[model samples]
Target: MTTPNVSTPRLKAPAEVASLELNPHDLSATLYNNDLAPTTRKGRTWSSYSIFTLWANDVHSLGNYAFAIGLFALGLGGWQILLALGFGAILLFALLNFSGFMGEKTGVPFPVMSRIAFGIRGAQIPALIRGAVAVAWFGIQTYLASVVLVVMVLAVAPGAAAINSNNFLGLSTLGWICFVSLWAIQLVIVSYGMEMIRKYEAFAGPVILFTMGALALWMFIQAGGSIAWSTGEAKTGADMWLSILGGGALWVSIYATFVLNFCDFTRNAISKKSVVRGNFFGIPLNMLLFGVIVVMMTGAQFKIDGTIITSPSDVVESIPNVFLLLAASTALLVLTIAVNLMANFVAPIYALTNLFPKHLNFRRAGIISGTIGLLILPWNLYNSPAVITYFLGGLGAILGPLFGIIMADYWIMRRAKVNIPDLYRTSPTGTYFFTRGVNFRAVIALAVSAVAALVLAFSPAFAHLSSFAWFIGSGLGAVIYLAIAKHGQEYKDVSGEEIAVAPTH
Candidate 1:
């Protein structure tokens, strides 16, 4: 069993980086060897534009419009909310850069990458948790997008709403058909593979942007063509600051699922430089501009309707032009599917596939996520804004520590290095093969920190802190992991051979 030189050069033109030969000895079972394998030595040649559009695909959705408008509930004005959003984006950019650099360096999905910090098998703990969240959101996002289709049908023929209005489990029959159809469309995209998903989003993102701009403009004009911007006045000094930060947290939580597994996307990037550049364009800058349009339209909605309209469906319903309504709704449906395909669908497929790679190749795993998605009753989740916010907050709370622990394990503890072969090994002697391929310290760190954070999230006594769950949980997880990891799980090794014995068992 052997690998070509481990000291491969990086940060070169994609043309210069040769593809890597599979390391014969380090290969794991076919399950581990599924799409999660660290064998993609020369990743797809994604330029800065691809990464930039990645954020566009990631963010350009109905949810982005809603989440941005939701921040107004915190009573922060447009400029203040924008400031908080930018701050969160800058910090997020740095975090993604750190993780994405690792992906570009390692050429593995997030689950496989976690093996460096979480033990080889233990990595499933975080992987499954992330996958579960993605699946729920995948279904929820599908349902949300389908709502637009329903709206379009109703607008085309106002009587169409009653055709399938027989409500079952909170969703009408028409709603179910639309939701299921959107789900199937996403499955088709996943069936085509990741590159196809990228190509689809590349086209969809720009078109969505134009459609959104037109909608926002129309809404503004309908709202009297004047900016009587409210200061979004706060009741108290503490409330104002809280509003901004809370808005920031919601901003973080908006795409929190992706933060835990961004490596999956970055791993496919052409180079580290490209990933960083792409994130800059995609995340912060893109969100900044997108949020501005959403805020402007939201404020216009408040003035005209006497209440803030966060949902795009509500905004489209206000438009009298049948042609415009149909066009906007159709554009939104396409954009939502594209975003769901990129953000919600792919990560979980890879994450769940990692759990039992032998049985669940990417396609099969995607089918499982899709099938399970049907059972989650995502329509109920979407209808309950308070419930869904907490659900997202809970996800942020758990993921924060997990993210902190992994980053700590990668950067602080191991100094951005790992014995690649040991990652797939089952031998107790292997560095990542601790205690039957599970690192107790990492597990304990995640459990303790996440539990404490989430307890606060659900606690009415401390419910206010839920907005900062990501920040607090991340800090606590990092600190706890840092303190415990002082025992320092083995990384440097004797012999300096940079290879592990191929496991036979």
Candidate 2:
């Protein structure tokens, strides 16, 4: 096992490094770059318990709660929705487990690991794609998180919601403050590094899970015998079956963004077993619990308020008791911070940092990524289904294909044997160097799959297929990539075992 040399000194910025290292004749071009190399061969530092809560933290966010609400609203019964969610969660588990194995086996992040299938140069295709998705979600989540903060303000002042008459840039003065405040808080938390993040998650994950359960119980009591077992959707026959399948597809698609970048987290897990065990329990079992909470809570809201309310902030606002609202909002704030920093923010920060390692490490790249979130005007985008559908759906259309291609290249073609150092080499003789560092083959596979999926996503005639965008795109890309690549090329590792290495030049 090899490790990336994190200590290697880099130039101050890309400009200085470009001049010094970009020269075609320079030895620097082929030499492994410190930031992009395979590092941290040791596995299993993070226990299964840590891994479990890590994902639990992801589930506990308001965005997820809201997403579950929308899925439930798709006319599936509560039990039907759970069953659908279970199917989706199982698939998610299988997908993340593969990514986790790669990460645990190699100890590199998603972008670096993807270089195997995409070529070190071509790998940027998936890197930027996944990173862009992460950043978009980051913005959406930041805006979502700030709702709690804004609610906190309203809970305290009670009259501040009236100040919305004088709003700016689509957000009221108070809204702007909360958004920026959460944004800054995220930066501060992210600036502290992954250890700090895990620590915060350790504390916050269980709190939010417990809080959600308590809220569900409280609301159920308030509804007072009105809590119905029905999900308000079809429960039997063909309509119910279609609703279940359709809702399942949408449910899986929701987490497709995380599926691609999961290596960023898995690389830190203590071992392959830990990763597998964690995801199995974390995503499916824990997700089931949260689903119940969301369904119950949403049902309670409907009974009491005459409408389904999924947003925690909205529920807190309606509490009427300022003290309870204040406590609830503050608790939600902590959970949202955990979700943004750990799940949404960190991946893009690394993906972008990988793009220009000399100029940006995690901290610097993070600021730039966070700024992009602000520019996207997430306050407007967060609440809209069309925007969510386009951004997340579009990303899945491309990234799903990339994920398929990478897995096929690694697992099927290369037989899990990586010629580790060759992944970083720029020598013409190097394997991954294809036509000026880009694998046109991988690019082609991705383009075809993405274009087809996007057509479905954006077009009304085929829009129904958009719901299954992830499954279709990934399976299509895999088949196409396999058809295009050379076969029967047996590779071997240093110890003389027959192996499947990354697709090379």
Candidate 3:
């Protein structure tokens, strides 16, 4: 009797099977490292309070102080500045949640998250833009912190000012010394990784907050227990409205870099509730508290002396007690380090690693990033308040499109669903491996939107609109991306895949 031939079921291809089981923790070196991989359960330890203190430390820096007070130079009254802060804080809260939600859901860093929107290899473009901007800010913050150190030294020993007479690379000998010293201190702190950074932030934020409150109290006493909040030069009608709007734009611009890369921090949070709660308290409420303290201190300083003191270092320099000066100076030092690490250093580390995940890990990337930051000589970029304002506007223009593309892809096109395994895959079998591992839709969208924003930011005819560059760019980016992507295969490929949700406790 002829037996019926039994046919074996066709076996799935090896690559296909592997793709189905591509665990984030076991991803290839070219696509993953300990630093760039999705956070493990143990790694997701940051509480709501931890996230709150992160903002607290980041907001209370000398550079941020300069940024906030610089609005006064543009003709905003203390009350207007506070209003702007609130407005910007609301904008920041929304933008951060858009980006932070991705991290909270996926437990991945910003560069890794970009892979969903931009292909695995194409992710490098946005990463490079972010890294370069981060390096510039890192150098700028380092220089700002060093200025505080220089002020402290000059206060303690007036003879240190002699070093200023011999200038090198637009900075004094003492300036170089202080800059390098602070740089090293930050590098040492970064070497301990994110956990140490979080702990340090918890300690640093409260110290600076306390010091700022005390400083404001002392200023109130010096001003005979009253502070006059003045409207500078009396702007009314469109001019006043414009100034207020610009001031709000400046507030957002100051935090634009952090907002874009907030996933780097939020991925470590224990819950989305933690991220949202922390961000609310950290941004809107935090900005309110910080803005009031700042206005009080600066206003009181103006009352005591006819000149406006915009710099925190200047405020500390004006203090009469040597002990308090020393204490305040030390607190400001902590302030700068915390903000620099939180805002500047951490971003580029992950970004550069994303560029060469096989060759670079976090520490190596940090070293390279720090070296580039030092070489750029950021003091040149930070000359005056006008320069700072324009610089941030231009930066926001470039970065806003990225934020737009990311938000659009995730929330609109993909409907908050990310293919976790595909994010690390470079093979065409992976959904994200479109166009030989590049998503030209995202590339084109970024290019077109950023160009438009840049024109608005730099054109003399559109100078009044420059302050709105971030808003304009981000809005244009999202709209353009949505328009372009709707016809693309990536948009159609959206399916109900089982996404690996991070445990939210």
**Which candidate has the top score in lDDT?**
3
What lDDT score belongs to each candidate, Candidate 1 first? 0.75, 0.74, 0.80
Candidate 1: C-alpha RMSD after superposition = 8.5
lDDT at position 274, candidate 1: 90
**lDDT per residue (tens digit) for residues 225-309 in model 1:** 8643553563347777777777777677665677778877776677878998888888888888787777778878887766877
Model 3 lDDT on a 0 to 1 scale: 0.80
Residue-by-residue lDDT tens digits, candidate 2, 1-505 = 9987688765578786687666433323332343344445432356687778788888777767787777657776577768888877888888888877876666556777787777877877788888887788788878877766776777578888787557788888888888898899888877766666777888887888887787888888889945655546455788778777877777777677777777776666777888889988889999899888877887777777668775766677777777877777788888877877766787787787668865776677878999998998976776778877787667767877888899999889988777765665677776677788777888999999888778877888986676787788889999999999878877654221111222110
lDDT of 2: 0.74
Q: What is the TM-score of each candidate against the true structure?
A: 0.87, 0.86, 0.88
Candidate 2 to truth, TM: 0.86
Candidate 1 regions exceeding 4 Å error are 1-23, 39-43, 157-162, 168-170, 223-225, 231-238, 381-396, 486-505
**Residue pairs with backbone overlap in model 2:** 4-38, 4-39, 43-270, 44-270, 44-271, 45-270, 414-500, 415-500, 431-504, 431-505
Alpha-carbon runs more than 4 Å astray in model 3? 1-26, 158-172, 231-233, 380-395, 487-505
